[model samples]
Target: MTSISIRSNIQTEIREFLKLAIPLASAQVAQATTGFVDAVMMGWLGQEVLAAGGLATMIFMAMMMTGIGIISGVSPLVAEAYGAKQNRRVGQITRQGLWIALLLAIPGMMIIANLDGLMHQFGQAENIVTLADTYLNVMAWGLFPAIAFAVLRGCIVSLSEARPVMFIVVTATGFNIIGNYVLAFGKLGFPEMGIAGLAVASICAHWIMFLSLLGYMVWHKALRQYSLFKTLHRLEPKTMQQLLWVGGPIGITTLLEYGLFTTLTFFMGALGTPVLAAHQIVLQTLTVIYMVPLAMSYAATVRVGQWFGQRDWQQVRQAAFVSIGLAVMFLIVAAIALFTHSRQIIGLYLNLNDPANANVLNIGVSLMTVAAFGQVLDGVQRTANGVLQGLQDTRIPMLLGTFSYWGVGLTTSYFLGFHTDLAGTGIWLGSYIGIATAAIAFIWRFRGILSKKESRHPINGLTFKE
Candidate 1:
């Protein structure tokens, strides 16, 4: 343990963590940039469009994350298999992951098809509801492709070959932008569809990204040896159960967190259009910065899983610590930047000079400060969860997430935003409270697990179980 904690060993682990995380982060950033582009374009269509598009996107993402989160079960499973040199198990897990993605799509598409009713129930305006519904209908076509891509991505990251994933997403980002432009303006002989065009562009991006990665995984000489295409038609029941058992909780956990954010839209919608728009812009900024830590969390899952699979408890703990530390440090800098550039950052989403945009811009700038502070805690919790997932201990964290994000966090936001002077800021503050609690609980859980495992297994005689 002392040797593993020394400066050189720690530095090596840090390097390994970054090696996996940076490209993964870049891929995440590219995907997020697609949404940022959507937000920027929505801004071009005016405040109503921005607000409506933001609302629609929030709903779409909540659905997408729910499915993808379940499919993400492949990540840690593949990592453990790869670590233990179980090539056949890796292939089986990856294939079953794809199956889970396909199955989840049925429900996801149904949810998309019914969003109008949901939006109406939330009491959204007629025009806003109409616009959001139209956007979601087109975006629904991308659901399976998007979820399938998640499975492919999980497999690749666990293989410790993430550069190709970044490549695919960066390419998709370009395609999305160009497609949005051509279809939105009726360029390249396409009929102008405006908002629907953006939705179409996004669908194209998802399908292309998924297909391209699938082709790479199948055809690439190095990767193809595993025969990922070997069992395409057969469904293994046990494999499916493994994926669902692990992934269902992950999916629900993701939904709990994402749904919390989604619920805030209703609160802002109740407050008025300006508040909603402001919240959306602030959300965009938060999403962009979040990719780094999100990537770190993913990297942590892989690195920690590898060590755990090898039964190297010391390295497992070291990997977990370094990943969390790096994410926190990076986000601290991001927080400082967010605080300093609040006005400038808000300007990217709305025109600060335009008197018409003043209210939304001011609200956004204020929320940016809160998001900046919250970002650090968010980094901690997310990366900590990654560590737990790597160790294949997800169910308890799921329970904790339910309590933290909903029981404590959501309850706090409801009171602060509706019953106090905080309003939008209160909502943001409340979400962070939930995030902070998750971070603390998750870290504590990690330490306790390590201590318990150490007592029972000792340093030299250790075996990890999922």
Candidate 2:
């Protein structure tokens, strides 16, 4: 291809990526915005309330990501099937996904319902443990809808119809925030429910999002042709097994990554409420930044899977590389913005003018600086993993991810946070190495797979088995 033609093709690919990525990112942003709303409202309650709420949120995230990661396998499967014009197979895959979502909800709810003892085991104060337990107890009720929402979302986004997902989620998030303010603050003659009210708002928000997407699937002319709800009770043992095989590693990897943050929260909880509250502020900011690339990765997963399904190896490579490049560039700029706006961003989550918040704000600024310096690699790892998911190449990536996060990141976090004076900041700095390591390993793995394909080599070296 001529240089001009190559540039045009690259530009075309970028536009395609952003078209899918932006809406997915918007949905994620809306979702994370609800977290921001919760954080700010918790801040209004008190430092201890904020601290307990933050811990509860992290644990909920860990549970939620585990289920979502597993269901995410359906996205690539649906993309490949749809791209190959197998509409019936797409329906089957989605049905299996919903079944998996329902099954996951059972154990997940049980765990969330009984976390009070676990909080006590962590040596948290009685009040903090009680508040966190109250939050999780209510949030457990929303877990199934959230998981089902992930399945429906993946199917739609795979079909390149992410706008509805974004619209429904944004609308639901608006409902969630409004509900939070009115119920938590007793704004409408409703008794203030505090943290429990926030959880109730989250529950209603997820149900709204779930039902909206489900309704769209039922009523929308284009999607209705797939008969997604037909045979909803049918069992597809092989398909469910495939999803589990491909997605089990994904769930474990998700657990590992979120598990890191959850553990860090425990460390912060031990340090005191001020440190925990500050950690929540910076972590929430980082989540907003991370959601952009995370959404881009999911978009790349759909695109690359479609290309792979069509047996277009070169297009697959192009789509993935463009996504990685876009994500990294965005995060590099985001890191700069975080560096400059550390105080202002923290101010959004906590009270800056209050003398009571001074220590939390100061800790938050320091943690924000640490995050700003380290988050670029996060983009690289997420997009690279997305490529692997597209190829159904997740098992080895899981191992590499576990080693990087636990072996390198969590280990360093513990030693640096407790064994030295660097404290919480050192813990944050260690994550940079972990993210970079995963980026290098995952990128290396994908490059190897691509090289094998480009060279017309045997498929024996494929990262995962069929």
The TM-score leader among the candidates is 1
Evaluate model 1: give its TM-score.
Answer: 0.97
Clash count per candidate:
0, 0
* Candidate 2, 1-466: lDDT as tens digits: 8999888988988898899999999999999999989998998898888999999999999999999998889989999888788899888999999999999999999998898888888878899999999999999999999999999999999999999999998999999999999988888899999999999999999999999999999899999777788999998999999899888899999999999889888988888888888999888888878899999999999999987777677678899899999998999999999999999988877678989889888888889888886888888899999989998888999999999999999888888888999888888878778878999999999999877776773333233323
Q: Give the worst 10-residue stretch by lDDT in candidate 2.
A: 457-466
Superposed model 1: Cα runs more than 4 Å off: 1-5, 460-466
Name the candidate that leads on lDDT.
Answer: 2
Residue 226 in model 1: lDDT: 70
**lDDT to native, each model:** 0.89, 0.90
lDDT of 1 by residue, 13-119 (tens): 99888899999999999899989989988888889888989999999999999998887788898898899888888889888888888888988898887888878
Off by over 4 Å in 2: 457-466
- TM-score of every model versus the real structure: 0.97, 0.97
Worst 10 residues of 1 by lDDT: 457-466
| Clash pairs, model 1 backbone | none
> Residue 12 of candidate 1: its Cα lDDT?
92
